[model samples]
Target: MTRLRMGMIGGGPGAFIGPVHRFAAELDREIELVAGVFSSDPGRSKAAAGAYRIDPARAYGSLAEMFTTERARADGIDFVAVVTPNHNHLPSARAALQAGLPVICDKPLTATLDEAHALAAVVRESGLPFAVTHTYSGYPLVREARARVAAGAVGTVRKVVVEYPQGWLAGEASGKQAEWRVDPARSGLGGCIGDIGVHAFQLAEFITGLEVTELLADLGAVVPGRALDDDCTVLLRFANGARGVLLASQIEVGELNGLRIRLYGDRGGLLWRQEQPNTLTLHTLDGRTEIVHAGGPQLGPDALSRTRTPTGHPEGYLEAFANLYRDFAAVLRGEQAPLLPGIGTGLRGMAFIATAVEASRAKAGWVKLSV
Candidate 1:
């Protein structure tokens, strides 16, 4: 099997998501990182690439130059991973795709709806697989939830309650992580909504197989000096007559990545939490509750395929993120059509962020998702 040679666009020194992406990409051994334009600063980029033991010639200062140089190499990169801030995703992705390489990007597809649309246009024109790492969608049990919902185990989805909260920014700012995330220019239109709320939105829709038709958003800034929202709550209306609520925050004191989703339907309901990803709670109308464990025989093939451990062991955030990369590598190798969440799911997330922001700005009015 030919290993996928990968290049990175960001994830220089002190960049958070970039290292996580590297870890995930390396886990399966099916992909190899050959080169990168890892930082905006040329010196920083050189230092970062050196730290990873990449060839200095392969570590260019800009994405365009990286694409050109890498393409000229006989062993060029098969794909590029875009790990920059919201504003840089579009330009870097376009540069790689135009050079005929597939792309895997981080979420909130672009900084604005217009940029996201333009990206979609390019993706359609390219015909190359573009994946967006909505990491939660990579969970094994989440895939099970999606399968069960699609199979009508939950007959006619009625309501979805997905909430994600953390206390990292409860009262005061912390590090560079908290700084860029709360800034309007770097984090995009909505803060908490764009940062984490969109994950909740994507989870609810992905699991229950229902599309949100409209949403009413209520966002807030719990910290004193922050410019953008650190907390948010949204009321959602699904196309299939299902009603829902989504809450996300970075300011819920003492709370970790406490993301939970509950979907209720005519036949039953299903519940899953991020902190305890191995077990999925299923509720039936007949008053029976069953716990679905990852890698068990009861799981569907899709869910089973994502699991790397036995039934009792645990697989959390990093594993989930790796699952996305593993599956994407499979698709890139012509093995499948992306059973895992990819560009389409990322586009949905961007739409969710745009809608929530518009709704919150419109005095908490309803916003339609046009993406």
Candidate 2:
């Protein structure tokens, strides 16, 4: 199959996510990075294009220019990856979708729920394949978990516990990450919730295949003088009457990228730790406990479909993210692929942020997910 020609936006010099996106998109050899508008500055954008070995003519100063020029060309980018900051996501995505190109963007969809909803409308109306890189969903064990839940292996989910904690901002903030994320103009309304919390929120819902009907959140700005909340705990109520709790923070001392989820049901319980993502723990009500490892014979189709190596080989974050790109690229080439999370999932992420903010602001009461 011919590789899908993909372009990038806002992943230029000193950008954290740009390199990550590039690495993931190129990992499986199904997509090729043909062009990009690497930065906001023309010089830096051109320099970034050179660094990535992109064609000089295709590297433009802004996303609008890239879209306009690409639309006129017969060999334009088949898809565009929006790796820009939160604010620029909507515009770049809108341009690509309207120009008859597919889109794959990083989460949280947009700065606000309204933008998310509007973008979702465009996707629905255009009938284009749009994928949001909620990267955790691509993990093999996570896919296993989803399979277990869907196959009735876990029997009626009763509760969920998901937590993500990082100590990158343990003390006074500095560097490009903290600078842009702390600013309201760049990051969305919620701080930690909008950042890593959305991942946790999406994981709980994605794995369980349940929607959070209502939630109560307690957000904190542990670092004094910070404009946004750096830590948050949310209590969730699912539409199926299940309850859950989510914790997201970037100020936990001594912690670095700790993400874990535990789901309990009437017949059994499932636990997955991100640090040791290759294994999943299962405990049944009848006193039987099992450990499921990746690449095992018992592995379901969802996990096996994306596994490129045998047992004992290490596959982690980057591999998971790459799977999303591979699957998305396959779908873009007019193939019948598995269902991928796109604008609807992105909108759910935005809804999570909005509900978390509302719940945190309320007088200690539960707030329903408006979506």
Per-prediction CA RMSD (Å):
1.3, 1.3
Q: Estimate the TM-score of every prediction.
A: 0.97, 0.97
- Please give, for residues 1-371, the per-residue lDDT of candidate 1 as tens digits: 77889999989888898889988998989888889999999999988987777788888888878888888889999999999888888999998889999999998888888888889889999999999888998999999999999999879899899999988888667677777788888878878888889889988888987889899988887788778888998999999889999999988789999999999999999999999999999999999999999989999988998899999988899999999999889899888945666667777888888888777877868777778
Q: What lDDT score is found at residue 138 in candidate 1? A: 92
Local distance difference test scores for all models: 0.88, 0.89
Residue 220 lDDT in candidate 2 = 87
Q: Extract clashing residue pairs from model 2.
A: none
Candidate 1 minimal-lDDT segment of 10 residues:
337-346
Q: How much does candidate 1 score in TM-score?
A: 0.97
Give per-residue CA lDDT, model 2, range 133-165, as digits (tens).
999999999999998998888899999999999
lDDT of 1 at 320: 94
Residue 108 in candidate 2 has what lDDT?
95
